[model samples]
Target: MSRHLLIETQGPWAGRECASFVRDAAALAGGGHRTQLLLLQEGVLGAVPGVLPELDGYLAADGDLLVDRYSVAQRGLKQEQLVAGSRLVDMDEIAGNVLDAAVKVVWH
Candidate 1:
């Protein structure tokens, strides 16, 4: 069976907690699971260019990377400011769709 992982985090990517969250998401995706990362609150910082290069490999592996549009705007960041592979999504859309479909969800 295919498993879906939804990882939600809210903080700067430099923190230990954020790093672990990214690591765990990548590891799970590497193990062949379908993984999606949702960056909210300060966690949207991870979507900033050069903030989290580790996520590149995961994206290359087909993992989905999303940044909350509200969070980006709250931080005065534009869509273009986000990393190349990251997509901007509404929190409601995530909750109604991705979250509902995910087999497991992790928050950090």
Candidate 2:
């Protein structure tokens, strides 16, 4: 059975678990686990290309990742700034996906 992992990262890496969450999720995806990263607020910073090489690596591998478009825009990140394979998702859809998933990991 495929398990779902929803990683909600908020804080910046130097302050909290954001880095760890991104690294772990990337590792999980590399290991063939079903994982997705949802970026909100400062969390979207992790999705910035070239800024986070670990996340960039996972994205290069086609990781299932989502960044709230509102967040991205609010954070001043353009669509081209997002990591590859990452999609823009609405808050309601994010909530629904979390509710429907087997596991939800929030790194706040």
Q: Poorest 10 consecutive residues of model 2 by lDDT? A: 1-10
Which candidate ranks first by TM-score, i.e. highest?
Answer: 1
Provide the TM-score for each candidate, comma-separated. Answer: 0.84, 0.79
Residue pairs clashing, model 1? 11-43
Query: For model 1, what is the error of residue 63's alpha carbon versus the real structure, in angstroms, after optimal superposition?
Result: 0.8
For 1-108, candidate 1 gives per-residue lDDT tens digits of 465655556565446777677777887788888788888888888888777777777787778898889888988999998888888998676776554754677667
Model 2, span 17-85: residue lDDT tens: 676777777777777777777777777887777666667766655568888888888878887987777
* Each model's total of backbone clashes: 1, 0
Off by over 4 Å in 1: 98-102
Q: For candidate 1, give the lDDT.
A: 0.77
Q: CA lDDT of each candidate?
A: 0.77, 0.71
